[model samples]
Target: MIVQHNIMALNSYNRLGTNNNAVQKNLEKLSSGYRINRAGDDAAGLAISEKMRAQITGLERAQLNAKDGISLVQTAEGALTEVHSMLNRLVELGVESANGIYQATDRDKIQAEVNQITEEIDRISKSTNFNGIKLLDGSLGSSTANVDGGSAITATQTDATQAQYVGANAVLNGVTFASLTKGDVLTVTVNTRINGTDSAQTFSLTYNPDKHTQLSDLQDALNAQIKEAFGADFKVTDNTQVLTFEAKEAGADKAIVSGMSWTVKNYNDSASGVVVATGSTSMTETKGVDAYTTVSGFDGGATALTKTSSSADVEKNTLTINGQKFVMVKDKDAAANVNKIDSGINVIVAKDLDQAAADIEKATGIKVAVDGNNLKVFAPKGAASGGAGLTLQVGDTADSFNKVTVSVDNMSSAGLGVNGLTVTDQGIAADSITRVKSAIEKVSVNRGRLGALQNRLEHTLNNLATTTENMTNAESRIRDTDMAQEMMAFTKNNVLVQAAQSMLAQANQQPQQVLQLLR
Candidate 1:
């Protein structure tokens, strides 16, 4: 009966507030369509949902990255396709030039086309880019050169001497100099072997009947031409009636004159100037070059170059030159093995000291000449002084994403092993055919690698998509609210709130009874 203490009304009011708060929460959830809109709604669910959302977003981004990777690969492959076609055409041209029916002028025309194609290949290699990133340039792959630790040899020089003829009565190689006229041109083709391959250079000497052109004058002119074309690689010397041409640098790698032929064109009295000596007949192989090292310096027998170790320590014993590492290994036969060098370079450690020296010279483009039991090693002529070798590193981790790296090598003519290709003569053309074939194989292999990378990226993209979809679904389950269920809850809470308000009113009326008693 106390009007001051309305406990029943107070309880009804508290219950009304609870029902109203519940109804408000239901309305919020229904409007937002999220069960866990904030941390207070569902702390544990919110945490899990946020983690899933992060994963979904990451997966989506990763898929995009993979697609980009695919596009890059496709771009590279397309460029290589053109390269493949051009290589095929080059092969055809090389074969065409090999026939005997084609004259020197015709061969020259074909060579011009070949040169143009080579330039085009280089242009493509330099220009082909994916998003401004060079694709076919040699920067992507490891440029490595393996040096052999065989018997170091000194430089050797082979000389070709020509007997000089001066007076009208004198004859050289069955050809009288008196028969030559002022306008007569002697075309000399010098064939040189570089890196186990033959390359030729043609030079013309114009005979002047007015100047009385001695053999010394001709020698000086030829030497100047050689110096200009080869950059100090060869020289010519003349004494009295003897004229000699020699490679400036000693060793097997030196550009030695393999063959030389001279044809007197537009000459007066062709029968009188018929040159007899031809095709390296005037050249003689000389021995006894200066040796820089003794046979005792090597580990194996004094005569043979052998490995010090029983097995190859590819990880340990390595020489890094020009950012490229050259690995030396021991063969099973206890011989010093240099087989790991590039296939283009033939470095074999043979029992014969001369053969071993030759092999080293051919492989490294360096001169190796034997001095008795000792061997001497000299750099190739015109080689850059203090030039560092190439370098290659494995397992580099500088990229942004975790991925397996694919190495794409240089796609230029030199990189493809077609540099300095000669399709002029039948012999040279035959050799060039083999070289072009090898180039084609290299391109094919590179294209195959690109295709493989593209396929792998496609798979990665698919996987990323699946992971993103699944994670998104999981996040939706944790965060999204069922509108239908929430609406039902809202209806129930609204009814409860209304009932609480009515009960609160009735409870207040009960307090009015005490007032009535007082009246």
Candidate 2:
């Protein structure tokens, strides 16, 4: 044996070091309870596990977000419940005022209560919030105005007349009513052109069976209403129980005839008054037009022209994009309004628009898209911030598909039209009753919308919880150390380390004996 180097001892010494390293690694994995403790352990697994851990964390946070969204919806809905109660109280007071037995002072007292209730409604709408984010107060509302409302707007426009309804304007057609009945209410629409624009004037004749039993009686009553409304310019005749209007002007086309259209309504169910429908053309042959309101000032000190009221057209909300000006019009009554819109100058107050931008582009060729926001420029719902509207992040990533958008309109007194309700007079009190009823409906509808949002968030939360649980399980499979398998490996390595140490000592002794032999 050579004293310079003991080859056997060297091999055993190297084996000891290898076994000790194995034991250390095994202990570490056991202590840490992770198969991928470091990059060296499992490079691919470490990367995958880390990514999955992030996803799990994100899912957990998303669940919390959904819960928060639900809480926000609840807060708004709860405030609306109080508003509903106040509206009901207003309805009660209005009904009481209608009783002629109540003196003017009593009516005054009812009006005071109404004013207070309206003020309280305004307070609740402005103050209701979740984590400092306003829920109602119109701050969270989309740019779309609910002037006519969704219920008023049809989801699908089937025909040209339906299309007219969509735009809230249509060409008036002349109609001769046939098969007149006792309970028929006829609407006489006359649209006269001034400066190439049709100004519409309408009068309605409600037929009572006791008063207007004959076709002549109905015809004469319409004549009387028209004479007062239209200046005795058109002549009406009931030939074989059919009413038609003729213009006194010599050069006017009989087709136009000032566009007199009679819409028949059978208010009484028992009374059979089926009016035959007839169609004619207007002087300009005007069609229906689309209307829209603009919200602008979306960038670097750009002034935002936000709509102050849904119904009130007093405030003009103009959007100037790329130097193209959009003007808000109160009256979308003319069919030329669509053509006016294409010129990029005419903007009208949109009413009863469900698909705010979609419907306008379909029937009318008006592209109603604006970018950016100002202080009043709220982000549109489901869209990224920089505009007005609330977006809830319900997903792990920045993908827009992972977010939820919420829209809540202003529920103030003026917003609901209950602010101007007065019961100081019987006739006004009777009108106030109708206004309060409408306000109650608005509150109920708002509550329903909030409830729907709460339900959606609840569903989102459940989905997140399930997704997080599954993802965590997958991550655990990849990253967690299996106790039984790891413990067995540890035991085997520990034994090998001890055996290596003993063998290393034996091999070193062999070298020591070489020195003894030399001596």
Highest-lDDT candidate: 2
In candidate 1, stretches whose alpha carbon ends up further than 4 angstroms from where it belongs are: 142-402
lDDT (10s digit) by residue, model 1, range 1-519: 677888999999999999999998998898888999789999999999988877676677667777777777788889999999999998999899988899999999998888888888888988988778777765564321111111112111111111110000001111234544555443333333232233445455444544554444555665666665555544554444334455455444333333221222122232232222222222111111121222212212322113332222221222221112223222434222433222221223455557756654443334557766544443221111111211211111334354645556667765675654667666567667877888899889889988998887777777777777787888998899988889889999999999999999999888677666767
lDDT string for model 2 (464-491, tens) is 9999999999999999999899999999
Error of 2 at 204 (Å): 31
Poorest 10 consecutive residues by lDDT, candidate 2: 149-158
The C-alpha RMSD of each candidate to the native structure, in angstroms, is 24.0, 20.9
* Number of the top-ranking candidate, with TM-score as the measure: 2
Q: Report, for every candidate in turn, its global Cα lDDT versus the true structure.
A: 0.53, 0.55
Q: Itemize residue pairs with steric clashes in candidate 2.
A: 298-373, 377-388, 378-387, 378-388, 379-387, 379-388, 379-389, 382-405
Model 1 TM-score (2 dp): 0.54
